[model samples]
Target: MRKTITRIMIPVVLACVFLAGCGTLAPNYTRSAPPVPVSWPEGPAYPATALPAASPVLSEMAWRDFFSDEKLKALIGLALENNRDLRVAALNIERARAQYRIQRAELFPSVGASGEGSVSRLSESLSPAGKGETIDQYGVGVGLSSYELDFFGRVRSLKGRALEEFFATEEARRSAQITLVSEVARGYLVLAADRERLALARQTLTSHQATHDLTRRRFDVGVASALEVRQAQTSVDSTRVDIARYTGLVAEDENALSFLAGTSLRAELLPDAPVNSVTLLDEIPAGVPSEVLQRRPDILAAEHRLKGANANIGAARAAFFPRIALTASAGFASDDLLDLFGSGTGTWAFAPRIDIPIFTAGSLRARLKTSKIDREISLARYEGAIQSAFREVADALAQRGTVNDQLTAQQSLVEAAADSYRLSEARFSKGIDSFLNVLDSQRSLYGAQQNLISIRLFRLNNLVTLYRVLGGGAV
Candidate 1:
């Protein structure tokens, strides 16, 4: 008996050793190169040394520190707490974690207990001579039913895949968080810009009203023509129309801000100041471009997805080989309930089963092929995500430089236009120029001021974009 048992166990042990040597089970997935151009266009030249030596990288700063306004920080905090989209993303992470737990459980043996009772009459034709006519059956068992030994590392690979998927979901949540922070910041900046424009419009309306009153006095004294008085009236009326339009815009922006913050608080509750009052770093410090692969949440999520896809290939390949399962049970049962636990009524069972895939009409092969194709697709998508991220960073950097230059130019134009309007007014008052010149000067000044506000807003928005593209702050 011992020799027979050793003969059987030796082959089983050798088989296990052979399967263990198969190695890794899953295909290796190397990081793919990004599809975007490695080098971006150099931003407009600026004095590199002009930036403060102590200035920190934008990504190194916490968002709360970067946005110093107490109200704005509170709003962001509320959004993070109550935003529906962020809550959904967080729920998905929980779901992924649960799935990972389920997959990991497969790597271990499962134990269970079961019991049954029945009474039956034996057929006369099947019964032996002198046998009882009726028989009672009872069973109770503790069992390990159909436990698979993962000598080929199949379960391990699957667990690895699930873990990667869990991480991927976590990264996805982080990506959503980054996007939310940027959105709130952008909206806040827009509100500030609109408020500034409204203030400017009101100021212009007051100045135009004064001019209209002066023209009316001159006309009553027979010193100005009716046409000059009419022009002044038109200017005042147009300015009033702009004020109404901007007032509506400001209300709309406040509503938007309230929605983004997940609250009913009015814009008045926010700080009433221009975004430029918050100091942004003079220069954006870019880390190594390759570091983006690790830092960017979306890119990391994509890579994890790729890893999952690769693991699936191994699981599919496993289907082509035989599956082995071991089952065992030990228990006691007796016809009399009182004797159910008696040693004489004890029972046990053991089974080792093997299922070979002899013929599947190419199904297994096709599944394996499909898995490989999916892995390829995931790899491509991962590469694409990286490329997209790189482009976003490059685009933000380029826009920042361009917008700054544009703002500077627009400021000079606004100053020049203001001076021209002053000279035109003085000339008209001295009776050296026509009212037509004054009207033209006033219109030009209004246009220049509007343009300047737009440029300032663009510059501020570019900074927001840069912060977002860099995956938000360290928080």
Candidate 2:
């Protein structure tokens, strides 16, 4: 039985190996270049920065190195591990890999073994002997069912398509990881800004309360007017209102941060440094080539899909040819169970079936056309992804170029407001100016400080944005 099986299987294995080398009808794959300019845009918004000969590869830099704050780094780490979106992306890669394996298996035979036994009794004139007779039979065999021989590379093309799709899924996971890192950093910055605002509000409230107390003492001595004392009380009440608003804002920020962390966070992971104090990431070196966008996982994923589409076209073309399947088995069989494996009981059978497409009413042509169209669509999508990435980088550059100026001017305004507030207070004490001047200066100073925090937040966020648009070095 063993020799008989080997005799039947040798030819089948050789045929599979030989025909698999027969090239696929799918057009030779050539990577398409991005439909974008070779260099980044330059103008007032995008300042030209020269690239050094040893410019570090941005894609190779780790996120930890990009973000300087240890606390923010820790938060990003937690998010990468626990974020639901990232986890889903990872699971999708596993599923795609399984699908690829399944497709690849089609290139070989599906071998199996089986055993059978039967007992029957016959009694009738229809029987050769007009009397009753009993019969028993048993058999065992090892064989392979129908397995397609890829003479035209139909199965191979399908396997190639599955492999490319698997690669695309892996890139998708990388893209998701990049997005998660950027989001966590942005959330941390937002929380810090709110906390700083809350602190500022509290300080303002205390100062207003002290001024109100001094005005009341002056009124008790019949030296200050009732109008001035009322105005002073108004300042205190207004500051208290601001304090309440900022206190709620801080709590909301904490909730958002916790949600991003994907679990209840300890106080240590929360932002402690003010928005300006935490250096999120170093400025991305200028003159980064447009080729860098190709490294972005999203763009790479799109290109993989395009390659898969190209494979699909080959599979469709192969469908126009005949499909040959081999189903063969070799074993031993006998009328008696005891003789099932005896020397004289060897048995074998081989069947090769061919399917020819005679009249499909243009369905084959339609399928081929559809596959070609799919390839074109994938190509367009790939190009579109490149254009989108270019636009994002340009936008980031535009905002980054101007943010420092805004921040610098805001700081100067804050300093001037503080001096004016101090002078107004001295003049009010000496009766050279009314309390309204001091109140105006205090409001201006508080507003200027708030604006400064916002600008700092924008500058930090711009850095984070540039990192993300450049693929975050998360690749």
Candidate 3:
């Protein structure tokens, strides 16, 4: 009899394995392509310089290759290692991976081993033979208990949800990393620009101070009026105030950079001067907006979440179907522990269960509806992410085209202002012009120089922004 049972069970178990390969009931997953221009907008909004025919793949370029500054490269490395947000993002990926594994495990049966011993005393009144008796039983077994038969793909759907979530988290981590790199570079550029501005302020203050002293001496000799001296003093005092303001700004910039770095940064790693030149691989073939936006980590993460939502809909739908579960065991049993594994002491049991939903007061229907709604919500979010990314890239490109022209025009303005200031100063000293003319030229030159520095910083920082928006960092 035992041999006959074993033969029957072998095929049953094998059948279960073979039939478990049924296809999932989940809705087919199809990516919704974002609606965007085939290429970056041409014409005035996009500068001609911003459009490249073909260039190195932006996503594959290493951050090191994109940022040529040694100090900036070191700062970005430090931030990637120590930033708390990035660490959290990375840890989330691991957690999601573990969750995915746990859900996937539900698709398979878990077999385990067990050993048991039991003793019972029976009273005379309750004994079948009308005599008191003590009985002992020992058993060893291997079995699978209450394992679901996923004929409707419920488990598969859940596993798919877990998988998509895992992918989403991984992409989120990548997004965090890209943002961190951009932030570090921006902070460093601000610090450099502030330093240069601070230097310019000090130089202006010194020149104005000398002019004020010379005017005071000329006034004492009755060769210059008190008005001229006061004008010179006003310029000196205003420049002194600018110097103090810039000093504070430079300090604040350093603090911001350190916070992003996740640790106290060495002075050597800080930019000593304002960023006059930014070395970056700014030229990239602005492929169709869809192609570029698809590579963005945030956009990818959103799409994964959308996929997960679709999987959840499958799980909810499967809930409306019947569920089947199986429990089985084969073991050795005997009244004495010594005989538990002896010949002819074998035992076996099989149980199968089915649960068909009779009534749920509309719970199943409501759940299915909720899952579908969630999927729609995810779809909207995915589309929104693509739109946001498209806008960012467009804005960056718009700035990229005109920045060089702005820089060039600013340099020319500065040169013209400097010449005007020099001529006015000479004329005032020679008694051919009022001190007011010198003051006006001085103001103009000072403003022009400040504007020049600002434009230069913008150009450098814009390159960083463009790189980030294009998803150019990290291979």
Candidate 4:
């Protein structure tokens, strides 16, 4: 028993010691240079931004601080807790971690204990003693069957690949969270803007309704013409149509917000103020392209996947060499049941195997080629992710640089339209100008008010999108 134990234990101990300290054949990973310019583009559309040199990156900031509105923050918090896409992403991380552990286990031997018994009838002619006999054999042993010796680091490389994949999964969850927050913010803003539009529609409806009633009274007394009364009625009818449209739009916005929040939202959590009341950070600086590549979760996830592909290439390269394994067992052997554990019953075994690929019909080469191609593909994807991120930042910056100018111009247009409506009404009341001028001015004013609401909505949504593309996320 002692000799058998030594035979089995010595090699197992040595394999474990060597395998634990071994390194993989995978090529060292080095990130390629970014595919975009080092600095943001210079143009009229690109905003010139000034920020403190020590200003934190968006990813490092807590999301609560990024948004100034309590209602939006509450809604975002609920979505983070209940979102299904995020739940799936979290589960994927767990699965990848388990897979990595399974791959890591390949670096060790699996030992097991077993007992066996065999009974056979020997024919007289076949027996060595030339007599019929019934034979019984019994043994108990500890054994390992075909345990691989990862001398070439193939197993370690596979483990490394699994680990990188796990990291990629984690980053993917982060990216999903960032996107969800942005979507929710934008949805809330849309709901708020729609509510404002509905309010404006109601105001116009009441104003035009009052004017239509006054004109009808005047026409009954033969003071206002029939055409003037019809014109007033037209304005009131058009506003009623707008009121219906905006009311429907408000309901749809709430529905979209509910979906984004992952549950039915309480009335208290819904937008109750105009979009202009919600505030975000000042337009962020487009510091450089590196900020996006280093901070964005989607880009980071792509980078991890690229590193994993590189690890896969190392494993594929290791497969071309011979595979070495060990099969060993130690036990007691006896034919007589009474002498099964008697003296001199100890037994041992050891088998070392080497499988050199003599011929594989090019399967090995094909796998190697496939792995290399996968690496190239991962590289392209990583770079593509970087490019996409840069473009998003650029697009957001373009709007950031010019949004204020557009808002100012729209405001001026509203003031002018409002003044024209007031003067045209006064002229119609004084019997100087036709009532058509009053109708035209009222329509212009309503259109300008609606457009102002749209511009405010655009500004708020752009801010949220900027935060997302810049890697600002709380969860």
Residues 61-120, candidate 1: write the lDDT tens digits: 788876666776777888888888899999999999999999989877799999999988
Q: 332-382, model 3: which lDDT tens digit per residue? A: 999998878799999999998767798999999999999999999999989
Encode model 2's per-residue lDDT on 238-266: one tens digit a residue: 88888898888888888877777788889
TM-score of each: 0.88, 0.91, 0.91, 0.89
Worst 10 residues of 4 by lDDT: 12-21
Question: Number of clashes in model 3?
Answer: 1
Tens-digit lDDT track of model 4 for 1-475: 9999789767856665575456777788998999998877778986775445986767777888888789999999999998888889999999999999999988889899988889999999999999999999989889988888887688888998999999999999999888888888898889999999999999999989988998899899998899989889989998999889989998999998888778998999988888898887764654567866798889999999999999998789878866788999998889976888899889989997767787899999999899989999999999999999998888888887788889999999999999999999999889999878988998999999999999988988888989988887554
Misplaced by over 4 Å in model 1 are: 1-17, 21-23, 35-40, 43-60, 117-138, 266-268
Candidate 3 overall Cα lDDT vs. reference?
Answer: 0.87
| Candidate 2 stretches greater than 4 Å from native | 1-21, 123-126, 218-234
lDDT (C-alpha, whole model) for all candidates: 0.80, 0.86, 0.87, 0.87
What are the C-alpha RMSDs, in order, of all predicted structures? 3.8, 4.9, 4.3, 4.9
Each candidate: how many clashes?
A: 0, 0, 1, 0
Give candidate 3's TM-score: 0.91
Comparing 1 and 2 by TM-score, which wins? 2
User: What lDDT would candidate 1 get against the real structure?
Assistant: 0.80
Clashing pairs in 3: 192-274
